[model samples]
Structure formats: C-alpha cells, structure tokens
Target: MKTNLVANCHKAITNYIHHTPVLSSSLINDIVGAELFFKCENFQRAGSYKIRGATNAILNLSEEQKSKGVVTHSSGNFAQALSLAAKSIGIRAYIVMPTSAPQVKMEAVKQYEGDIILCEPTLEAREKTAQDIVDKTGATFIHPSNNTNVIIGQGTAAFELLNKHANLDAIFCPVGGGGLIAGTCLAVNSHQNGCLVYGAEPFEADDAYRSLISGKIETNDTTNTIADGLKTQLGDKNFPIIKEHVSSIIRVTEEDIIEAMQLVWERMKIIIEPSSAVTVAATIKSKLLVKGKKVGIVISGGNVDLAKLPF
Candidate 1:
C-alpha cells in the first residue's frame, strides 16, 4: 500500500529472490522504434517473478502462522513459486491445481516439494479444495494476487528495474489477476521520475481492460487464449491500484501473442511464456505511442510446457 512497505519487502526478500537481469535487444528496439529494456524474470528463482511475491508473503507470516504452513490454488507459475518459496523457508506448501493444468506445471510443483491437491478445472473447485486444505490443516490461504503482501512483493521487480534505469518513459506488464501490474505501478510511481505503467492483456480474455472502463472487476465467459497465464480476472485488491496507476491496457490478438513469443525466442534467444509475450505484442501494437521513448518490458515468466509450443 505504501512505498515504504514495498521497500521493506525488498529488504526482507533480498537474499531469497533473484535480482533478475534487464536485457535489451537492438533488433527489438529497431522494430518498435523505441529503446526497450526487458527485465528477464524468466531467469528468476522458480522461473518467474511470482517468487518475489510468494517469498515475501511466506516471510511475512508470524511464527504461529508459519507453523500452520501456507496454501494456494494456482495452475501455473504461482504454484511453483509458492512451493519453492515455502520450501526455502522450511515451511510446508499446499497447492491446489486444476486437473486440466499442464502436466509440466504439476510436476514442477512436486519437484519443489509442494503437496498437490488435484481438483476439477473450475474456479469454484480450486477454491473449495484450497479451503478444505486450510480447514483440515489450519494452513493460511494466500490469494495469488489479492493479498497486500503479495502485491508489495511483486513491486520489487519494477523497483529493481527503475533502480537500474530511472528514465524509462513507460513500463509494460502482462495482467492476469493484476498483482504484477498493480505492484509495478506502485514501484514505478514511487521510485522513478514519471514513468507510466501499462498493462498487456489478450483480447480473448480482456477482463482487466473492460474492468478499467467499467469501473469494476470483470470476468470472461470463456478463456480461449494461448496466454494461459493471463486468463484469470483481476482481483478486487489489485483492480483499484491498477485503475488508479496504470496508464492504459492494450489488448492483443492471439496471432500477435504468438508472433511476439516467437520474436523473443528467436531474437533475444529467451524462452518467454505466452503471458510474458503479451507485453511485447502490446508494445508492438502501440509502436507510435512508444516511439522515440525508453520503454521497460517485464517478462513475467518462462515456465512453458515444451510439448505444447504454440508456434
């Protein structure tokens, strides 16, 4: 909520998470007619920026709460993040994953020593399963993006980005449940001079885009986008922050998402998940707005199932 809270979170999780690299591609810059700095969170511990928030959330728990352990429902990166973060702090993690979630993500959660609870692929099922765990085990349920500590923790990525380059004209992030972009808005506004925050969302699942215009949270009837990580709707906690801080939300098509993913893999030689690629696709789609400016792109994660490449 406050800049100092984010700074304190950074201090708490400094040794726990990676200060991921900021990379730039000349070819990419030329293509967009802007100097782009890509914060490569794909190299982060647990292979995503979720670790920042997950670690912070775990570390902030009291001794009593820590004894009860932690639990969350995530089908992808956050599942892996909470597992690894809790393991690092010698706490147990309970992960409720949908049966339809990619096998690779489920396996990664196990690899990090998280206890997995498989449930039907529905929001209701996932939440119910997680709540059952909390009731039975007394574990605290951590909402992936809605928790205040998680939001502050996620802000660290942009904090580090602005620390390295303070003159960015804008920072772009892919919005799912909206933690990353909400946190990003706080960090950039708190630390930098006047860098604007922008959100990238898939047209197929543009709840955040619509929510901003409607002045309330929105949901999608069907999530038919390849950017699986951005399929979730914005939470109440993060929606207000995003509405106040984010400059705009750019909705990109499925084709543009694939093209952007391929471009990063081919040109930057980085393996970014489709969710991460949405930011690049949005940036490309709004080339004129970013032209002759310094831009920062937050590559949210690199966790992808190799067998399911959308190329």
Candidate 2:
C-alpha cells in the first residue's frame, strides 16, 4: 500500500469521522509501567472506529454504485457504521447480521436506517446472504475488513492517533478481521519514526496469531470468546499488511480480558467493549514487550451489551 493512502484517507474522512481524543490514566500507566496513550475510538460516532472506514469506503464509491447502494455482513460495529455512513450520504445500506448478534447493536443499525438481513450465526451464512443481496440489488459489496478502500479508511484512526502523538514508541491494537491493525500498521509505517505495531487477540480466536506463524490466513476452530468482536478471522487483504508490519500478536486469556475490561471501566471510567479491552489485557500480560517505552493503545469500540456485563 502507498504511504500516502492513509494521509489521503484521513483528509477525505476528517469531516465525516471524529478525531477522537487520546486519553491517559495515571493508574493504568503505573500498572503497565509505561506512559500509555489510549486513542479512544470508543467515543467515536456510531460508537466505534468502524465509522472511519465505512464513511471513507462510501465516499470513494462511484455515483452509480452509491445510487445502487451497498451491502456487507457484520456482527455489530461495522453494521452500525455502514448504516450511519450510508444514511449520511443519502444512500441505502444492506447489512447482513448473524441471528445471535447483540440486540443492542442490531437496534443501533436499524436506528441508522440500515436494512438488516438476519442469517444463521455463521460466517458462511453471513457471506452467502450478503452476496445474495448484491446479486439481486446490483449493490456494491464492501467487505468489512477485506476491501482495500475499507482498510485505508480504517487506518485513519491510527493516522489520527499518530498525528497527535508522533513520538509514540509503539502501538497495540486488538485484532479480529485485522483491518484496524493493518491500517494502524500503515499509519505508523508512514511516519519516519521507528514506532512498532502490535496486535492483541483473544486465545479463543487466535486465528490472526496463528496465521502470522504459518504465513497464511487461518480460521478459528472455536468462537467462544467474550470479546465478541474479535471472533472474526483475518482476511486475505488485511492479513498481508498485518504479517508485514505488525511486530507481534499477543494472545490474552478470557480471564485477562474481563480483568482488563473491568480495570478500564473502574479506573479510566470509560465504556469499552471486550474487544477493545483485549489490547489492554495483552499489554498487561506482556509487559516485557514494551517495558518503559511510551506506547499507544487503540481502544477500538464501546458497543457492549449492558445486560451481559461480565463484571
């Protein structure tokens, strides 16, 4: 990917997306043994950083494609993002979601005027359903993590982060489909500074970690993690960038995920989902990876189900 892609994407989507604040906690800094900056995408529009990519992807669409509309399959954040993004541009968005997805997220998508198509709670079902929509409506298919435009858009979050804290030693982000982290890598790489990028993953859905080891995209044998958003596997498009730029993938346990989630809520007083907490958990679990170094952690989103609080 061109280095200028992230800069161009940031410019294109600046008005559409939030330049979310970078937060720091003395307590968290003490625990992690580093001056950590949390790029809080949890406070972003549609309640996640997914809005950045969704808005950019829609903006880059041809007028004919926009007129025909767009379609994608997402369990939560991207569904709400695409819905809101399309609505802002006065276009239709078809979101295929798993039947088992959080009700709160499903409702958020509806509130954004997205047409939700329910499918079996499986990746195959979601993809097939979304493809069916594209086939019938002649709508453009925007893969949540796998498309080039979407990846560039996702990088804008990190681009914004790096712009604020140009001297960061490293950055840790939760990896699911790898879009966010891949974009993050691009953003960090674009800088002349030698800032490293790391990915955090739940042990239950360690496909990205395993893929990095084997040098090929891998699938999860089980999707039993509390970090619902990190359950998706990396795609061919984002995986290559991740493998090339990410320093390493740290796998954290479910217990650690909850502990980190509770820590951020109790300390930072921020509402972050389990997926977002994975980055913090990984940092706490592997202090050796970034000891004494000033680092940045991307708080990916804040769309947790209130009724299902793990704490």
Candidate lDDT values, in order: 0.93, 0.91
lDDT digits (tens) for residues 1-311 of candidate 2: 47799999888888888899999999988898888999999999999999988998999999999999999998779999999999999999999998998788888999999999999987789889999999999999988888888888988888888888999999999999888998888888898689999999999999999999999999998889999899888888898889889989999999999999999999999999999999999988878777899899999999987888997
Per-residue lDDT over 50-130 for candidate 1, one digit per residue giving the tens place of the 0 to 100 score:
999999999989999999999999988999999999999999999999889878888899999999999998889998999
In terms of TM-score, which candidate is strongest?
Answer: 1
Off by over 4 Å in 2: none
Measured on C-alpha atoms, candidate 2 has an lDDT of 0.91
- Residue 40 lDDT, candidate 2, scale 0-100: 96
RMSD of 1: 0.9
